[model samples]
Target: MSDRKSNDEAESLLAGLMRFTGQVAGGTLEIARHTATMTAMFGEGWVRQMLLHSMEPERLEAMADAGHFLRDARETAGLSLKELADSLGLSDKSVLEEVERGDKIMPLELVLRSASLLARHDPVPFLIKFLRTYNPQLEQVLEQWGVMALPRQYERERRFVNLYRQHDALRGLSDDEHDRFIQYIDGAAQLVLDVMQKEKAANSPPTRVPKRPSPARKRTPRKRS
Candidate 1:
């Protein structure tokens, strides 16, 4: 009888220990899954930040040269400096000006916005060009991690891949040819902007004239005296 009682107590303790171990294992798995989800969502941004913090001096200068392309593209698109700066959510136009002048490192976010707006919503070419000029090391990092490939793949699969195709056609242009091509794009966009302005003026409501104030009587001064 005593021996039976001892066996019952031993079995209960063993069961409790096994249950506790299982619960701990389950909790660990849940934590790991949550970690992975967070990493997938934010890891690239974190990596980019890290890379930006460690940029080399020569790369920084090259970035200034790369930045002129944004100015060229913006002008080609017929966008005002303020318009592009506003689209990038900058508080001051000078911030964007500095970036274009290469007085500042172009933030990754700025690059994306500039590329998208200047390239007619196709950001791949500008992104590749800018990164190659601004930070080849970062470009290599993104390529190795498959980040760069994503945009190219997206461009290839997009319904408007014609833009991408057009860019590809210009890849072999001599420097002078490229400049002429840019001039052509700029002229076309400027023509469109002019047409749009004319249409806007034609369609706008006429300005309302303000009511003129009645003239004060000359006798008012004599009355006051």
Candidate 2:
């Protein structure tokens, strides 16, 4: 009688576990499908075709390059293996090796040191580099089509991607709301572009400096990279 009871309990537990697993799997798929539908609906205008026909290779390359740059930047900071570990409150010499090689997930402290030591005064450039490198084609496409078009384009894309990913939120919105969201994307892109272009032009180096009879030789703008 005890043996039979034990078997029944085991079967009951297994059934519960299977149901739990199925729910998790089902929920994840539903999320992905919703995301696809939203993007298909709003990845319109320039990236509509590109998004539908987007390639992943360029993205992979950009990420890899950014990772390599991060590693190199750390090395260039003159941080010794032991020193970086000390900075990270780690004592293991091999730890830095693993972090640099991507063999292990670098801890937050280590990443902070990397961002601080390598990126120094500004880490934003490194990020922009990653974006530019990882999705060169997309970057190129965005640059050519919408980059100069408006900052709103960037802003709209950012928000739309987020909203579309939030399954709970996306599921709640009606079709009309989705259309308004798409329109926001278009308007935002134009607004951002117009503002950025104005800022760029106003601050740009004067095409011709007022002629000074004994003018100092015109200084060249230093390249950031």
lDDT of each: 0.66, 0.57
lDDT of 1 by residue, 15-90 (tens): 8657645654454354446546756877945644544455566565566656776776776566888988788788
> Model 2, range 39-144, lDDT digits (tens) per residue?
7777634433453244356544554555565565555565777776676677676866644443323433455556666666655444444433322443454454
* RMSD in Å for all candidates: 26.7, 28.6
What is the C-alpha local distance difference test score of candidate 1? 0.66
Candidate 2, lDDT over the whole model: 0.57
Q: Which window of ten consecutive residues has the lowest lDDT sum in model 2?
A: 99-108
TM-score of each: 0.36, 0.29
Shift in Å, residue 12, candidate 1: 51
What's the C-alpha lDDT at position 31 in model 2?
39
Which TM-score value belongs to model 1? 0.36
